[model samples]
Target: MLNLKNYLCCLLLGVVFASPIFAQVPVQKNTFSGGITVTNNGISLLPTFTLGKPAAIFDFAVKSKRWSFEPQLRFSLEGKPWSFVFWGRYKVIDD
Candidate 1:
């Protein structure tokens, strides 16, 4: 009888502690969708590749309630094969 009482108490405590997890509600938030950027690197003061040519950049962004991801690709409008850049951002604190 003592063993049965202890088992019931443990089960009750476990259910109480785990109930919140099953009742969670998801959050929704606003986020940026897409953007565009145009840049010229031909006349850069610092020595670099591309030799100062105009390029068109396209960007796409995807975001969750607590996380954001952005991927960008760049190509020379003048038919020069340049480089591709990939990046992402994560939210640590909300105000």
Candidate 2:
């Protein structure tokens, strides 16, 4: 009967330690996403490629809780920097 008692105690300890694995976390925390784009002359009314020099653009964003920061950077193909833009945002209303 000693073996049976030891087995029951081990099972109880395992269940107590593993309970937190079943919990759920909020969806709007510690999120990161980004993209790389290659184009010419930025966004234009007419999407013509042959009219200007080629460029590469980088965009990325990081979000945590109710705040987020996004940045956009651009550069030409010949190693010339073009522009930089930063967006800082906060959630005022929740849907």
Candidate 3:
């Protein structure tokens, strides 16, 4: 159930990472991120932890290259609505 933004971003990342031109280039080597989640019922769940029942959770991710991008995929455990978003970084940052 992947979304368009995820596919596109992953594709672009693959192209950037797989090309022989940047093969030897050593950019950022790693990433680490996590956030706390708050439920509408007034409960909070920290990352690496889980709530006993269905709850709203928010997540974030970052890509570290100069022209990097991040796409998010989200799903609901209740009504099961899903979505994807593309955000952060663009080629227009030519500075």
Candidate 4:
């Protein structure tokens, strides 16, 4: 199973490449965007079974130029933690 450390590494790599200091192309002004989603089951890529629990998922992002900082949070109705994912994205091609 993938661990938090592995995910962190990937996020870091993206952030490094997406830094404005290194980007050559012109980028748009900063923008804030986010949304919420409700799900019936909080399954984690398992083909066998599901959690069968109701969950609330939140996704938010701050974007500027060719880079964006997006973070996602998931939790059960009972206030239990499901998962947390953070993504740093860079636009390599704008076509």
Candidate 5:
């Protein structure tokens, strides 16, 4: 259902407020930010995902860190909804 999809997106957005991994474990702090976005992937045709929209995205990354996590937030379209992605990275090579 459309409502269900929206709810899932909302949940992702809300829960993604945690600190990122690269922030703590990094050779250098990378504060990378980009412009606003809308309708990245065209899954909009699906009747069940009518409300499928996207917003802007931000990515912050660090390298050579251990036990770190990077949290990502992406939108479906303009004012549509947001999804949360949590990633943890460990440095295998110290170099």
Candidate 6:
């Protein structure tokens, strides 16, 4: 089975790249996203025994014509730890 971190990385990359593919729909200035991740004995890449380790992720994005801000939260669904991430982006001389 794949490790949790690697699996989550791939999932996030997929979400980021897949956004433009849905361009036929109207774009929203604010967006919210969420997902669940699960793994077995591969949470930290070390050799340990764990089963059905699950986590939940929540993210929100605020977008304008030339700037964006995103904040994300991730926590264990099974009473584990949690973390938060924030991102800011701006367009500089878009062509």
In model 4, which range of ten residues has the least summed lDDT?
42-51
Q: Pick the candidate with the highest TM-score.
A: 4
* Each model's lDDT: 0.71, 0.78, 0.54, 0.81, 0.54, 0.63
Worst 10 residues of 6 by lDDT: 42-51
Candidate 2 clashes between residue pairs 3 or more apart in a chain or in different chains: none
> How close to the true structure is residue 18 of candidate 2, measured as C-alpha lDDT?
78
lDDT, model 6, position 92: 92
Model 2, span 1-95: residue lDDT tens: 99999999999988997788776775655989999999865552345523266888789999887789999777788877766778899998854
- Angstrom error of the Cα, residue 13, model 2: value is 19
Model 1: lDDT equals 0.71
Q: Please identify which of the two predictions, 1 or 2, would achieve the higher lDDT against the true structure.
A: 2
Q: Deviation in angstroms for 58 in model 4? A: 0.3
User: Residue by residue across 1-95, what tens digits does model 1's lDDT show?
Assistant: 99999999999998998888778676686677777667876333245645467877778888876677787666688765566656777788864
Candidate 3, lDDT over the whole model: 0.54
Per-residue lDDT for 1-95 in model 5, tens only? 99999999989876785456335653564443334334445333245544443345554444333445566556554544455556778777665
Query: Runs in model 6 with CA error above 4 Å?
Result: 1-52, 79-81
For model 5, the local distance difference test gives: 0.54
Give per-residue CA lDDT, model 4, range 29-86, as digits (tens): 7999999988888765454534578988888999887899999887888888777878
TM-score of 3: 0.34
Better of 5 and 6 by TM-score: 6
Q: Whole-model lDDT for model 2 versus the true structure?
A: 0.78
TM-score between candidate 5 and the true structure: 0.37
Q: Supply every candidate's count of residue pairs whose N, Cα or C atoms clash at under 3 angstroms.
A: 4, 0, 0, 0, 8, 0
